[model samples]
Target: MGAVRKRSSADRPPSSDRGRRIRRSERVPDESGGTGMRRPIWTALAGFLLLAGCAGGEAASDGQGRPDYGEIKSMVKDILQTEDGKKAIQETIKNDAVKQELLFNQEEIKRAVVQALTSEQGKKTLRTTLEEPKWAATVAKAMQKENERLLRALMKDPEYQAMLLDVMKGPDFEKMLLDLMKSPPYRKQMQQAIQDAFESPLMQEKLYAMIEKAVESALKPGQKEKGGEKEKGGEKSEEGGEGGGK
Candidate 1:
């Protein structure tokens, strides 16, 4: 019987290696920049208020405190549904910089970010009962609402709306997202890309150079030892026998 053929590279599952080559590139980490918290200040502030308020209540003493999840969800839903909220979002989409980004890299940017936010692993860290979860469900729900809001806002920005519809329907959307994940730049975002990219290009370059220098210095001794081992192995073969005795 003929041996079973192995799956060709193209036929195999997508590579574990994902990058920011296409649409997802913006999401990737740029170690060249300073690392800081990627979370929005308002989110951090609200969390502080939530924890402080909770600490004063009976729920705080429970084995697991019940989150004011309904309140949070309502806030999120309100933000997305209200007229002023929608107007602010539309304004964001209308900003020249944001418009350029949306129009130029809309397809890739959306796919990478949405894929990262909605991925099984991404959602896992974001899951848990609201009682025990630290802003988990709230965060997820807010993101979902925000994305929905953005898509609706896109309708007003005809170029971006067209781009989104082009890539976000049926199988094309799934493939685009999967492609975004496998692309290097985007997967980096899942780790901590946003914080790093929020800086000037020159500063980012300097930071990366420092990191590279540190890594090289740390590895220099180990690399020398490996080089010595290889040299010793070469000498041993020369002192022993040549291949085919020639």
Candidate 2:
């Protein structure tokens, strides 16, 4: 076998050396050089960060912006002033269910009113108002009208008339009347009424005629007996006197 010749550095394969050099040169640099193939990635990352920062700034600005309360209030006022809004509110209030609820709560409302009026302060206020002459007069006139209306209504009710008649005919009512008649004040009033009636000329003439008739009736029989006795006594007395003279 022939002795192999020593391989020299210059005799090394060009392909292997070239491949190693190419690999070394192809290694990505770190911060020492511009990104070559990664340029688009870096650019994309940078652009994303910038956009994020812009978005953060916009959010910060939105957070710092205050609401326009005055404008909001104006808008609300305008809405309320609209005809549709008014109609909606009116319709809600005029609902049949609302009316029924109000009717059902009427007793509660009346109780509340009675409770309030019965309170000391309410009573005092009412008294003060009623003490005013104008208020009192107005109340009196209203009460008079109410009483007249009630009287008219009662007069038109046959049942009410029957009830009244029954009450008047009742023993309790008779007792009440008898008690009133027995009272001293009632007796005085009745006597005064009688005296007033007798003061009339017609009553006085009737009374005088009744007394004259009563007196004539009482004296007629006695007058006849007395006349007969007087005639007999006078005749006897004449006869006695003639005898005495002889």
Candidate 3:
């Protein structure tokens, strides 16, 4: 009123300023909830969305992604079902080196077999089997046939027979026989056998027959006349001695 003020811009608030302040205050009310509680809820919701996005990104990556087990299994199954894969497996097992190793271990296998057969249980089983009549008979028959066949084959070999004869005729064999006969035990056995034979009744009868034949032969011809003269002389001497005594 004093200066009839021209109402310059600096003397009063602009109408636009009032409108802006009112809009700001209204916007703040809309953003905030009762006691401003919606602030934390909105912040937590934003953080959860950020983490979900990161997890989704990681799941989509190639190297760090989850494994596709079904795909891997299918691939493995396909490879194993192929002909080449089967052939490779078979060749590994049937390799020449494996065959050679088995061949080289044959002696070890034989030793293992001998050890097993020589064990106490094995001996007991063998004894039981041999004690069984049927089993023993069968084994004996087989062994006998084998022995007979071997003997026949050996007898058919002329070289073997010659070797046997040579051995029998060797000086070593003659020395062995002479040594046996010279042994004191052998001499005693032979003497006992001879004495037993001479003590037999048939030997005594034969000896008596031989003695009677010898006496008959000695008494023949001039030998019998000389025997009768000696007997008559002996009887005269006996009669002379008896008369002198009377």
Measured by lDDT, the strongest candidate is 2
Task: After the best TM-score superposition of candidate 1, give how far the Cα of residue 176 lies from its true spot, in angstroms.
Answer: 39
Which of candidates 1 and 3 reaches a greater TM-score? Answer: 3
Compose the digit string of candidate 1's lDDT tens values, residues 118-143: 99976775454444655766766779
In order, how many clashes per candidate? 11, 0, 0
Candidate 3: clashing pairs of residues: none
Model 1 weakest 10-residue run by lDDT: 1-10
The positional error of residue 210 in candidate 1, measured at the CA in angstroms, is: 93
The lDDT per prediction is 0.76, 0.91, 0.88
For candidate 3, write residues 1-246 as lDDT tens digits: 645566664587889989999888876655436537777889999999999999888777954567789999999889889999899878876999988987999999999889878999988888988999999999988799788999899988999999989998999999998999999999999999989988999998998999999888876966769999999999999999999999
Q: Write the per-residue lDDT of candidate 2 for residues 1-246, one digit (tens) a residue.
A: 122344564466789788998888778566656566488788999999999999999988886697678888999889889999899889988999998999999999999999989999989989999999999999988799888999999989999999999999999999999999999999999999999999999999999999999999999999999999999999999999999999
Instruction: Report the CA-based lDDT of candidate 3 relative to the real structure.
Output: 0.88
Q: How does residue 62 of candidate 2 score in lDDT?
A: 86
Q: All candidates' TM-scores?
A: 0.19, 0.33, 0.23
Query: Candidate order by lDDT, highest to lowest?
Result: 2, 3, 1
lDDT of 1: 0.76
